[model samples]
Target: MAALSRLLLAALLAFAAPAFGLAQQPAAPEAEAPQVLRFRFKPPADGRLAYRIVQRDRVVFAGTEKARAWSHVVEVRVGGARPPDMLEATITLSDVRLDEGPADDPYYLVAKTLEGRALPAVLHDSGAPVETAWAALKREVAAGLARHTDPETARGLAAALDRLDPEGVTVLYRPLYLASVGHLLGFNTDGSVRSYDDYTGPGAVMVDGRWAASAAGRREGEPVVLELGWRIGMDPDAAARALGPVLQGLAEAAARPEDRAAVKARLAAELADGMEMSERADAEYDYALALIARFTHRHVLATAGYGKEAVLEMERIAP
Candidate 1:
């Protein structure tokens, strides 16, 4: 019986050894390399979705729209020895999130396009010239503005230009032409400024110029009002260089206590609109002046709000 027990134990040990050895073996390698980023979004307009892959602020690929509902599946090649490539198709849900991996991942090569494709962004493919497109667009806009200063034309064109994918020439150049025409003659007659904090409030700025106007809205925190506006006139190049200093000076002055008071007093006199007298009104006045001053510094007439980030748009402007 003792000998039989020993034999049985030996047999069990032999079977267990093979099972354990198989478990210790390394697992099969990953099927495909990790992807860079994956996003899902509902189709817009035609539901035909296209992807613009960017890397280092340059667009590498604008994928052809693969329409299958709103779902898209984009595979951005990350790193390694070659330029990141796209996967089979973008056939995922419209609300997909991104999953990024190591730098060595191929996806990083195409990350720029992902970032640059924002609503108000420009896409520049590696084969395209973002700077040149910007420059040409700016030049066309400047030339057009020189010819006509129509606010509708200017604003329309600016908005259109802003929509271009920085990667392609056609997309970049269209806005330039539109903006140029607008700057030459772009001013609307209906100039209205209302304070949201105090409707019919006194703490707002309204300036309708030969080609542009300044509009103010109610202030958020503090009893101040926010101001915004656009205008078109003057030589695009000369204005950018010459008026830039003046605009900067105004920005500085508006932020100053004394200057803020002076501007408010002047605005009241100009509009003859009832002034809502309050110490806080100075802030609203200052805000308007600052925006105006900044506007003066703008060489290119952009219709949207870029604020201090205006420099990014400026850098893209054509010479």
Candidate 2:
């Protein structure tokens, strides 16, 4: 029986090897690869970009799996006074829709409110807003919330504003600011893409590539590093909002000797790793544009059996 099983396995490998086309071995580096590649945007003459973004999320918890997605179109226009390297833009959002999953879900519903809304000043390159811009956005957003006359809605919005204040709003709005620019902006010299193996990648600009690769080139081929891992910060404001409340509650509750003992014992069991519950994942990006024309960054969360995965993707829709 063992010998038969081994023979069958060997036959399977023989068949699979041919079907898989061996291993897609790399060509001679000098022959196929450019001396260097450039992966930076060539801004249009109008200093405007029109794009479509799709946000997707899936979760499996206690034997149930759920997926949700939102699609929206954004237009960004840049100009006015700013630093040499930095640029400010008015970002407009429209045509928002819940593309997949639960239609009544709050996560999907919130996107509807963004229809025809415009952010006055967000960084053109990074998608993040400047400090003053953020302040203005927050004020405008709060005013919108205050327009709710119902007691329940008003209270809920007030609580949300308080809780999401400081950095929480930024965390939630990161996708809006980013619009998947991270994938398009960070390329090494020679137009090469981000290297997850090294932290030097990401958050770089065209100038950074000029310094590293000497000069940028129009990529005739795909990126050298096609697939790599990326560490994404989904809810950077977590420490202050939900997590902070729990820690603060624990501190307040541990006033008595018995309470302190109980709290310490519970923490010892739960917090063995010192305040980090995270996993690394290789985010998904579709280089439709990266290869030749426009592109999309389909940033996905690996989840690693934790059962929570998300994808924030965007595409260049118009010239």
Candidate 3:
């Protein structure tokens, strides 16, 4: 039986080797997968971008001026016997407006070229150096756009794109700000607010004022990072009107230790209503109240700064 078990194990190992393509392993182990390139396009500028990935002096992959808002994926396998060296490259951007671009321009191109296209030319040229793809891809893109009127040429361009691997190319762009009073952005490991400004690779952009983050690429299980910041230019009256009383109540409760439980209960009830708080303290109070209700094992509502009369009002639910 022991000998039979050893033979079974040997057979399993052999089967697993083929499953992992280990039987076809070259003299050297497979090279590590190339890291995806990252790019950031913040507000106030737009321009086209292009890129080419060359391996063994052949354009393994090439793309031009895709929109930034639409994430893209491109992949290319430099098919050959010898190991291929992957080269990554990008283009520089100048201002171009979305309104000015050709009507047929793809969504990804619009996103990539946003900084140059969206903002004023003067402001666009002024702010900062926008990163983009390589010159060769840009040149090809320009040539391709010129052929848009020619059906055959346009078809060839589309076919070329189809051949390119659609695994790595991605784009992210900011959308309009909401009218909400407050939002929670994400943070980096070092505690700085994460922003498109700080992005060096494809990362999530919390377009809806920091309460959410969406990854730029479709790669499975990629980590999405967030950082919170207040949006300027929102109406102060709106925020104040929304937050004032809630903030005051939280302040009062925080100051009264004996009333903490009642305060917590109130916060929990507010949270249960699916209300969005304009102040961080109120949000924290809601979170604290939730934790107490979940884990405290005893009701603390009597001490929630509410007198006996108020306690009676809550007693039905407090237990």
Candidate 4:
């Protein structure tokens, strides 16, 4: 009977040992530290790269909510194996949807019209378009302009209507513009220097197989893997200098409360005149597009209130 009791006690303790051991087990070997990959910007070789970009924009004014979202796939190909290369990019927009809260929204209309169109563009090292791919965009915007009846906004848009380069409009509306700008900024003129440090923040890291930056302790992968935070505002002095007498008159007129409405009207007319002048006097559209691209890229990266958000995911499709 003594031997039997001892055997039974041994069995009971053996049964409880595993449960006790589990309670003190060392936490599964500390989850094996996450694999981290430090990103280095390599000058892209002569290969094709593909990416899917999702863009979301939302606006709220006077308790009215309006939202517009779209997704597009971009394909970029590098032509030369060496520096001073040419880039051929194609953007195809899809899944564009809009939710407007019973408010008059023309932007929603524009987005709807832009869906399902693949725009192909080519650019040289200087960011000059090698092909005229603005025909489709010009047609679309012209139609929208004709249909747009809002006086307050229409005038401003109409003022710069003819001067609207597809590249400039694209930079305003899509994330692929950033990719183009990034490509240009990533490589030097001769493709000798590849510096990505200027575009990445201290918190940038690879997380879950994607490059991400920590903002407010949360990882964000949008438009860029890292936040460049490039904000280049239009220099008022430069604008004043460029406008010369026109800016002076507008400034003087805007100083008076009574002349505000008149000043606005004059401003619109002057802008229209300036567009006409730009078209007739010089072929500065290419240069203007370059400037606009840089400005728009910086503006998108810097401004949080624009309600514009873009996510860029890169996949190496070929060697």
Clashes of each: 47, 7, 54, 1
Model 4 lDDT per residue over 121-180, tens place: 665553333443555565565456444335544445545545444344343233433333
Question: What lDDT tens digits, residue by residue, belong to model 1 across residues 227-260?
Answer: 2332223322333343333333333332445565
Candidate 2: misplaced stretches above 4 Å? 1-38, 102-110, 124-128, 131-158, 162-173, 179-306
TM-score to native of every candidate shown: 0.17, 0.52, 0.18, 0.38
Output the number of the lDDT-best candidate. Answer: 2
lDDT of 3 at 292: 10
lDDT of 3: 0.23
- In model 4, which regions exceed 4 Å deviation? 1-84, 99-111, 124-132, 140-161, 166-174, 186-229, 234-236, 239-319
Stronger candidate by lDDT (3 vs 4)? 4
lDDT of 3 by residue, 129-153 (tens): 1222322243345355433334543
Clashing residue pairs in candidate 4 (N, C-alpha, C atoms within 3 angstroms): 223-310
State each model's CA lDDT, in order: 0.24, 0.40, 0.23, 0.32
Ten contiguous residues with the weakest lDDT in model 1: 303-312
